[model samples]
Target: MNITLLEAELRRDEGTKYSPYIDSTGNQTIGVGRNMKANPIPKDWTFPLTDAQVNQLLAEDIQTACASLDRFLPWATAR
Candidate 1:
């Protein structure tokens, strides 16, 4: 998968958030759609996340999703 393209799409679709906010589903979200309920914010982090931090969270979330696919749907990622 072209992660760069994927990141761009996610940023465009989800938009960036420096501070936590309630999403449409009412989930506490921060960064680039980083669901705080599934993964709580790090204790070291503060309210306003920097661009670098948001990007980091985006990358981590993508990685976690990819890993889940690899484990549960190996055939889907065999490309």
Candidate 2:
């Protein structure tokens, strides 16, 4: 899969938000659909995040999600 394309799509769909806000699902979210309630990184994330920080978080989240998919469905990425 093209990660660059995926990131672009996510940014368009999720829309970047520097400040934390409640998501439609009621989860604490910020920075390209990051669910703070699930994985609250960048400790003491109360302050508005910078673009670099948000981008970093998005990369991490994507990595984690991909790892999870690989673990659960090893054949998925085998091609």
Candidate 3:
């Protein structure tokens, strides 16, 4: 997963149905329904990064994710 290609976004999802929650000690049940929609990513993001630069950024982002996810990846796959 390229970090550059992927932007960190906080998405608000709307709940389908009402869900009741039991508080600690079972004093009272609370119903919380409907989740707010996730905000869209900011547009007009400027960058000096090119496609190549973005790819590199993504590879770097995954360095800790799986150890060697980027090791086999290059600009093009060798036959």
TM for candidate 3 is: 0.25
| Poorest lDDT segment (10 consecutive residues) of candidate 1 | 39-48
lDDT of 1 by residue, 3-69 (tens): 9999999999999999999999999999888899998878999979998889889999999999999
Query: lDDT for every model?
Result: 0.92, 0.90, 0.31
* lDDT per residue (tens digit) for residues 1-79 in model 3: 4343333321112111222333445432211121112221124423433454443333443453345434555533323
Model 2 C-alpha lDDT per residue in residues 9-76, reported as the tens digit of each score: 99999999999899999999999999988988667665688788999999999999899989999888
RMSD of 2: 1.3
Residue 76 in candidate 1, Cα distance off native in Å:
1.2
Candidate 3, residue 1: the lDDT equals 47
TM-score of each: 0.95, 0.91, 0.25
Candidate 2 worst ten-residue window by lDDT: 41-50
By the TM-score metric, which is better: model 2 or model 3? 2
- Candidate 1 — which residues are off by over 4 angstroms? none
Whole-model alpha-carbon lDDT for candidate 1:
0.92
C-alpha displacement of 73 in model 3, angstroms?
Answer: 22
lDDT of predicted model 2: 0.90
